[model samples]
Target: MAPNPGRLDVGAALSYGFDKFKANAGPWLGITAIVWAVGVAVFIFTFASTLTAAIAAADRGESAAVATTSGVFIVVTAFGTFVSYFVNAAFVRGALDETGGPEKPAFGRFFQLTNVPQIAVLALIWTVLTVVLSFIPFLGTLLTIVFGFLLSFSLTFLLDRNEQAVTAIKSSFDLTVKNFGPLVLLLLALAAINIVGGLLCGLGLLVTIPVSVVAINYAYRVLTGAPVSPAR
Candidate 1:
């Protein structure tokens, strides 16, 4: 039988994601919310502190010092973002595995996975590509959107494959390139949710985060030709 080649069903994807959330809403939401809360608090504190430091440096007429401090803040934030990506991937995978399937990954195992050098290298490469792409004018903006989608999809793939991080990253790029349209729509949906989440002082994120995890899982399954189980 010929497979359906139409647009990927956004409605079906959203429904699947919602069902997955309903199945294990309590534990998954509780844990994720708490972790996100703490993460946000820490991020705000750091951001405020850095801003104050820059202001003080500027007040002292030390523009060079302010620039140096701003640079350091950027680097720290970038590093933190990279690390958080792995942590979120680990959490989503663990939560889904625990609630939706038989195997339960141990808490903090995702952090342990980051200890492998390949993971860091993969993250660095992904980061560099994203930055370089952002430099072009109109095309750069379009590429950024496309690249962002591929990047998210790729990260989920890497997390699921359990291969060396570099290999996983390569696989993600390959899968995304091969399935561009559907993946782009999926990524756009996620980005919309994130923007809404941000607008609501992050409360909307409670809904978006879990939905994203499931969506990424769906994307991964699609790319790998895995069986899609009914939502529990």
Candidate 2:
């Protein structure tokens, strides 16, 4: 089911996302549960001891004590974040496919790591860029937010289009620039939805997260000429 290539329309894409998510709630929720459960466990296992030690050092009046552990924390956190991006890309791929066709998405599909390297490269580039810019005072935060939204679809492009990391990043940048206004609006809307989800004991994310992914992919379909079903 090929999507009609058309100008990106944020409202239509979001509507398609909401409807698609409702149609496939069970599988989406199951996948979200599995991913987040593992994410939480890994976070605790990796950082619990180190974090406690850092706190203890700070209490002992040694402000520099935490610096030693901070390197390890950054590396591990980056690694975990990289992996999560790939996993989420899988979800985006499956959701986009299911929305455009009759077949359901498979649970194992998101684990396919064929594009892991590209995703990692993209993640690494963004992390470095954001961290560097974050040191620049007031403008840093605003730049990060704008660039973050502009390149939001980099991983999805890697997974869905099989583009190289640099290529995917460029594509995402161009797409966002072409549809800058709508993309900003979409980002804000998604942020609000996620905040509401967080307020709902975090369980509401089981719905909002997938819906967000679907909306982004719906926009991807618009830009890439993939077929999108009418919003139900």
Quick one: best TM-score, which candidate?
Answer: 2
State, as a TM-score between 0 and 1, how close model 1 is to the true structure. Answer: 0.75
Worst lDDT run of 10 residues, candidate 1, spans 103-112
TM-score of each: 0.75, 0.84
| Residue-pair clash count for candidate 1 | 0
Q: How close is candidate 2 to the true structure, as a TM-score?
A: 0.84
lDDT of each: 0.64, 0.76
Best by lDDT: 2
Model 1: per-residue Cα lDDT over 42-114, one tens digit each: 5986687677767767766787667867675666566665666655656656534643355333444333443
